[model samples]
Target: MARDSLIRHYAYLVRVVVGRLVPGGKSRLEVDDLVGSGIAGLIRAVDTYDPAREVKFETYATANIRGAVLEAIRNEDFLPRSIRDRLRAFDRASLATEVRIGRPATDHELANELGVTEEHVGRLRIAAVASRVGSLDDSTSGSEGDTLRFGDMVADPSVDLDRELQDNEVREALTNALGHLPERERTVVGLYYTENLTFLEIGRVLGISESRAYQLHGQALSRLRQRFRPMLMAA
Candidate 1:
């Protein structure tokens, strides 16, 4: 079947599926948002739908709609500053300690290198672990798996050489700027981008609440942004 026609035919099913999944909540997501997402999913599904398959369209379209909505959320991107700072700190400390000692930094070594205690190092390690262990309310309007994919969820959109070059430039600038940041600042930056840890994870790493982690991270980022405005703007 032609993709457009197939989608138009089943688009109503998409809305029905999304409505069933994400009933209204305190969230700001609109039915139209889910409808749009479902339609996109249906189009994709049409390209791949099998005529012989006994499975219902609802089951298949549900996945597509959820995927689309999830993709949008991923694009909207929820992250906390404390998370970013802890990450930056961890990245710098690890690399610096690794090069200085010619090996991966042990918890003891990482702590000593950063002028913190072994317990503190362990906190950072806990923070660095990748998991969907969020206590945050992640329930959505659909039945899609809500597992966190951190860096994997980050979409890459380099459409051309110029864009790619700009991305690389931005990455390089961030690296240099991160290298120059204080440990707290560095950790937050690294946690969010490199370690792919959550704000709560960062708080665990730094022996603070997730909220505190956010505050520190914001402060660190604000400082970095103020200091590196020219370079960042150029990027």
Candidate 2:
């Protein structure tokens, strides 16, 4: 009964972890699948947790849940070989452009370098980010059957602030990275992560196509990931 009660009480945590890991429903894996994996992780946390560790259960369980979801995603070879080849080609072209120009390459530059159209590059960028981390749009179902955007949940004050505060270093690094982004890229990040706008909505706000918005988001994330790599690895 205690285990079952623990699972029941912490079930919402599974959804939270799933929402954070796979923000948009763009992954080949469904939200339900990731939620199932997260629940398994939560159950494991409940079984293995140590009261004397001086760590909060929520924090410990969060790590476990994230790991489980990531593991589930990794176990699936979801991308086609053709897409994988394109992703590799895009990466090579991006690096070459960066080296040649002494700066991160824009999507247009990379497309030209790779002998592909800008739209092709845009899709590749979207695929690149999606393969690593899910998209920034879309919503997941909350524990009570209500739709909840992860961004909104993050902004909600009722969520545990202490858990958030524990990641001050990462948060600070991200803020600094965002400040360094180009104006347009920064706007896309804010609108996507803060305003919780889908790429289509962001496009309308910025007077661009939805695909262009995705390209900007992907570029912003690539830069942020480069900056955050060290901190994230240590974390």
Q: How accurate locally is residue 109 in candidate 2, as Cα lDDT from 0 to 100?
A: 78
lDDT of 1 by residue, 1-235 (tens): 5667767777777755554344233155555765677678677767765545554555555455545554443333233445535534654576445434444456677777778887665444433321111111233111122223322222121011133224443346445655887888678757754675666777888888877666765565455545443431221
Model 1: residue 135 alpha-carbon error in angstroms: 26
Instruction: Give the lDDT of residue 90 in candidate 2.
Output: 60
Residue-level lDDT of model 2, residues 1-235, one tens digit each, is 4989988998999887676556453444577888988899899889987767555677667656765665565455344455545555665565445435544466577778988787665555444444443223322211222333324323211113233324444245446767999999999878766776777788899999877887887787667656544332221
Candidate 2, superposed: residue stretches over 4 Å from native: 2-13, 25-33, 48-67, 70-171, 230-235
TM-score of each: 0.35, 0.49
What is the alpha-carbon lDDT for the whole of candidate 1?
A: 0.49
